[model samples]
Target: MAANMFVVRQTKGTVLCCKCGILMAPNPANMCVTCLRSEVDITEGLRKHATIMHCPECDSYLQPPRTWLKAQLESKELLTYCVKRLETDLIKVRLVNAEFIWTEPHSKRIKVKLKVQKEVLNGAILEQSYVVEYVLQDHMCESCTRFQANPDQWVASVQLRQRVSHRRTFFYLEQLILKHDAAVHAIKIKQMDQGIDFFFANKSHASKFVEFLDKVAPTKRRESKQLVSHDPKNNSYNYKYTFSVEISPICREDLIVCLLELLLVWGISDRL
Candidate 1:
């Protein structure tokens, strides 16, 4: 009677790992942790050596196939660019962490350490880390390349000039341009003795810049167009536009001073 009163309990079953023959819970690959990690390559198709296209002239990097992006040394943007380059292969697993392994700036090599995880077995996650070295390859960005090809080639130009003894007016104008992002379409911004030159590939962009200057600064605007070429068949004419912006020569703290002797000779100051 006592022997018939006992409750029956079932123990969990186990299986042997294919390679190591270690007894473990049932899993998809039928392999232990050590063997599965060694066998499975979560970082497959990821290149150990990568190339990042950089513009030596502008100190910018080529983002993917076409876009040019400016990124500071060891900045988050640079790190994001590195990670995006590995996006195709990294889709296979989840990225845990990625950080830069600092190297000399002059070395032109960026090292990124990546931690990735993959779940190959039943409820078992495998994590691994590896470093990828990115070599900066000299590739001129589109703007710089175009500029080098033809420095004078532009459809529109903005000649920004301030006729003042100091550069404070130009400095303020620069801040306004940055605030409004007025020069987004500018091909190149050049510092000139007179002031700054903003070149563009489109006439509309130059006109926009002139409008921006009108709103921000007290300036006079002049426009001129030069005929570049003509398509007789299409009856289309190509012209290059130029917008001359001259900021006022007046200063906030300036005073108009006349000497008493000079005023006496003119007999104007003493008339009041």
Candidate 2:
């Protein structure tokens, strides 16, 4: 019985499975070796679809190699599957401007007219006229820096129009502002009849600021809204929401500098 037990133990210890670090059962060959090789092959096959190359010069679109495209498709499929299983919620992110306009209409008949003269790119003359009504009251101009309370300090009839919308419009405006601020290194704010105007030390900076406004402002919506009441006796009221962004001169200067630097770097890198 002792000799039979010794032989049994020797036979069991002779064939060890290399892959799983286990003693092989009664088999003709090593069990772990074949299994380990198969596992490696499977891993390699899975990884074969993950290789891709991106352009280093410009971060724009380039023709993708076939293998890279296949890898991207496979990765996208896996990501979609995982995301569906996880039931993720999609987030909607929108950029809005911080400034807006408020207007009040008057029933008092006062004749006010505005004449805007602009020159087109083709040297064509453009002019427009609009009637404005305002209650002219004697008050000091809040934006004037004159020491004496001159009679010329009266708040003139002015129509306030916000130059930008509450969206990506301001983002570009912020960029143009930054460029001018950096170039001039100083900014000044003047309260204008329309709203508020920004002035840079350099005249070109001011021009650029105006151009930026013109480019972005045209995209704003000019639709007016009417408030309707259910009561038959009451009349519906019309209201409009105008968008504008306002910042203190000091704060605006600082922001312009920072934004310009950041955007300059981003723009350069993006086009590289």
Query: TM-score winner among the candidates?
Result: 1
Compute the lDDT of residue 219 as modeled in candidate 1. Answer: 89
lDDT of 2 by residue, 15-43 (tens): 66656667655343354544544433211
Score residue 17 of candidate 1 by CA lDDT: 92
Q: What TM-score would every model get versus the actual structure?
A: 0.66, 0.17
> Residue 70 of model 1: what lDDT?
74
Superposed model 1: Cα runs more than 4 Å off = 1-45, 70-77, 120-122, 126-129, 175-184, 249-272
Q: Poorest 10 consecutive residues of model 2 by lDDT?
A: 91-100
Please list all clashing residue pairs in model 2, or write none if there are none.
57-272, 97-166, 99-244, 100-244, 101-242
The TM-score obtained by model 2 is: 0.17
> What are the lDDT scores of the predictions, listed in order?
0.84, 0.34
